[model samples]
Target: MIRYVHMYLVAILLVAGISMSFPSGRHSKAEAANDMSVHAKAAILVDAKSGKILFGQNMDESLPVASMSKLMTQYLILEKIQKGDLKWDDVYHADATDQDLSTRPGLGNVPLYQGQSYTVRDLYNAMTLVSANAASRALGRMAGKSDKHFVQMMNDKAKQLGLKHSSFVNTSGLNNQDLAPYQVKGTASDGENKMSARDLALLAYHFIHSFPNEMDIEKKELDQFPVTDSYSIPLRNKNQLLPNGKYPYKGAIGLKTGMNDAAGYGIVALAKRGQRELIAVIIDAKNKKGKRSSKARYMQAQKLLDYGFTHWDYQKISPEKFLPTNQQKIPVENGTKEKAAITSKTTVTELVPKNSHSIKAKLTLMPKFLTDQKKRELPSTYQPYGLIEVGASRVIPSNDRKLTELTLSFRKLLFFMLISVIPHF
Candidate 1:
């Protein structure tokens, strides 16, 4: 039941990864509004439905992703929850080994008494909503063999997911040696995580698509964390877009946030409108420290989300016209009055705004279609070469006349022949 359908299909459609170039003036009035004036080291806007890179700037540039990397940590832990390996109510014992990097005065952390145990749900909530370093480290250690070994698991997972532009040095996104104790002492790695906006977006997109209900853990309140002793610590969601925040954007969901002198301010924000859920990765926002909290990141994320909603329209690319469609029913050989129907195999999403012209989805048909009937043969690779031009609402076919004619007539004879061409975004 480990399905790789989407990943496999995406690989086939893309000879390369997402295109990095930003859209030009030819786009619609709304799409052209993508003219962004923002501050960040790297940023990207992605359509979760189609895996389309709606917008990117310095997206491929690798840099410390800060606590944004914790989203991946949360992902690994959630995977265990989804399986039978871990449960929400399961309690873990916190000891000297669990003692975090610092007793920093105001740092987001839940104090633990020796020999006391806390539920996995409490640790998870603290990690997700408050961005607690100790919570994340504890979870990694508990989930994997050790904090050091778990860092290995993180990198291995990154390779398996095809995150080429990412590398993990620690489970918790801490750069200072004093902060992360999980890493072996005297190791070369300073314990900082690095990833490009595109790679981070891919990981977040996969997480959102795979675990729908489990992600609800983020919406919890700070006061919800259980208090073991007289120390009653309350921590609010660092993501300001969520409810009861300084600047609550409509439809904003609770996401992770990170900040440090080197990493600056960063966030991976998610929002949904009807069927579309947009993921915006804003990294390395300017930091005046307390004077400017994570507001700049939240504001930039809102802008990107606004652009995605205003600019694009989704349309399904089907091959009904490219392939011949019989009138209601096509008679089947050696069968009753029942006739078979012809349908296209390609059903994909393409993001093109309304009234946009000049965008084309060119399909390169294989050379076999151009030869004579006697000499005609499919590519030795055995892949379909039919082409589809994608646009706002049109799927323009580009193929040799002989191939078109043969397909139209032959399609009527075969009851269940599927159209070979796939409409990729």
Candidate 2:
């Protein structure tokens, strides 16, 4: 009896340990249900391929991005690498600015000595995996002569990419004092470093889509640098969801996280489960001691990924099916031909959710007609009129039989009138 009781106790302890190791189903469901309950200033979930916003709250409100700025840094660096302007093995020397930026407390540093040489690959790894300020500054210096010029390039690239509400004041995001050289012109406060959740997600999407190979760098559980022979820094992903392994999801790749006292906690997470990939951004999440913000972001991202996977499916709707059956031929006045045929240039297909149907399109013709302003002098050749822009909405198609007949009749009448008038001339 004593032996039996001891065995039973051991079994109970083993079961409890297993349960603790694995999250309960009830807890998972609860977490899924209350994913958005965390205190965050803004959050957004976007379809990685289409860039469609799946869910969002306060996404447009711009906020400080902290180290999330490194996304752009990584993007630009990779772009340079692809362009063959820079190589990963190329060695770069740290400047005074790089040393100053890296030495700041609270910011991650690569421990670069002034004029020390480091490879572009090492700097990139440090900037991305370790969020090293020194590496970022070194990259900026390597990319351009000065941080200001590199920042200008960043802003220019942002504008080109349609990031309307984003601005970069510094490469390192160091706070600027009134007397500081990098401070905003004619202002005491630090130069503004801001980006909206939407913009950040879009940036993430571009990074992941443009550079699939570089993404592996982010997934590294550990990477060693030859900078120091004796010392090795174990690299761990700042994102906890990647290692959780409990969630029924896959294709979750890599992204970056950011935080500063002013910016709070900002996250740009990318995940893919099956054919669908999503990028999520959480900015200005209430830290409440900083630990909870990452947890909140993970919960929110998990819920979003689950929701997307459950509710969304990709369908290849052929554009030909949505096109108008009858191509419009309009009479051209005083041209080589009496009429010109206008047809839809391309088919429009949309990837929409299931159970959704009925897409409508509207075409607006510019100049209304092919005739000139005066409508008196007929041109020698038939000139194509205005452009036709197609817009689609989820609406039932209306019957236009009577309108179609009237349009045909008007075209015939106009053609005859033009013919008759040409002879009279």
Candidate 3:
């Protein structure tokens, strides 16, 4: 009699542990992530190939993105050029107004003559390397046939790109001083462009994947001299991550940079080593004690990229590797033999940290044989409760090198186990 009771008690404990894997929870949100100490108000890191958000903080908060908006204009230019609507050798004439705006103090520009013309190739080089406002506006005119039409196209592209929180106010993001020349109705009038860190990283990802060939120019800074029909125009790349720039990081590559009083210093930064590519964004990283530091944004972005590369890697994890059998059968409360079977939901084989370990499976199975009509035959004092909702359960797809995370609530499992079985207790 004693030995039989001990065996039954052991089965009860095992079944309780399984139910505890997941139970009804009253919590509303996930716990906070570990500290990274990133100074940017909003930041995110995304895997280039998988499009997975490896790290994020305030990723959906829309904020100004200064010169970074230029990437959109750059994308449109590349698309038009690729589709044969525009050619590299085609001429673009910067009117007298464009020249005047270029010469404006804080507005980045390369000189142009009113009547003189520049090849499409020269304008692209200037825009990517120097982030020239005049260069972007000229490309905008060509892409959309006018500045207003170009702004519309930018918004349209943002929608198509699935940028729910991104909108462009201008091509170059030079919203300083008098608004007369730069004003475009319906766009952010302050010359500020707004995008969440996630959306900005998505933009960079879209640009790189769509026009893989164009990244060559952004990999480094260069002295550019695009000659007009009348004079030579001098330009230099301003992105600090470039080889010749002040804070050049070894793996940093092509993208764009933007800054204004409102947007602070920001970069849509990309880095590659071996086969791994990472896209990181840091926006509104300002030094409150003094004036804003351009290097802060760059350093933050570099920090994120380095952390992702160093701590994160891909590995395959299978529950079967750790379990005696992938499937198990448990007994119903009154059954003489185990009839209900449960198996590991899925395996995880996607990008995980170097230290990631296999997760233990805790699953509860209810026999399909028990029906409502059968339950009525039991004593009124006996209550049965083991409700499983497959749809609501945490089931991650383990195919195609993807990782499905698993979580269990031991408390709920224990409650279900003790209540459904052990009728006398």
On TM-score, the stronger of 1 and 3 is: 1
Q: Is candidate 1 or candidate 2 better by TM-score?
A: 1
* Models, CA RMSD each: 9.8, 20.1, 13.4
- Stretches off by above 4 angstroms in model 1 are 1-33, 100-102, 180-182, 221-223, 229-232, 287-293, 322-347, 357-425
lDDT by residue for model 3 (289-309), tens: 544689888888888888779
lDDT for model 1 comes to 0.60
TM-score of 3: 0.69
Error of 1 at 82 (Å): 2.0
Weakest 10 consecutive residues of candidate 3 by summed lDDT? 1-10
**TM-score for each model:** 0.72, 0.66, 0.69
lDDT of 2 by residue, 269-329 (tens): 7877767787778776654454545465656566666766765566543222323345244
Error of 3 at 351 (Å): 1.7
Note the residue pairs that clash in candidate 2. Answer: 251-272, 319-348
Task: List ranges where model 3 is wrong by over 4 Å.
Answer: 1-34, 176-179, 186-191, 227-234, 287-291, 316-349, 359-425
The count of backbone overlaps in candidate 1 is 4
Give the distance in Å from residue 275's predicted Cα in candidate 1 to where it truly belongs. 1.6
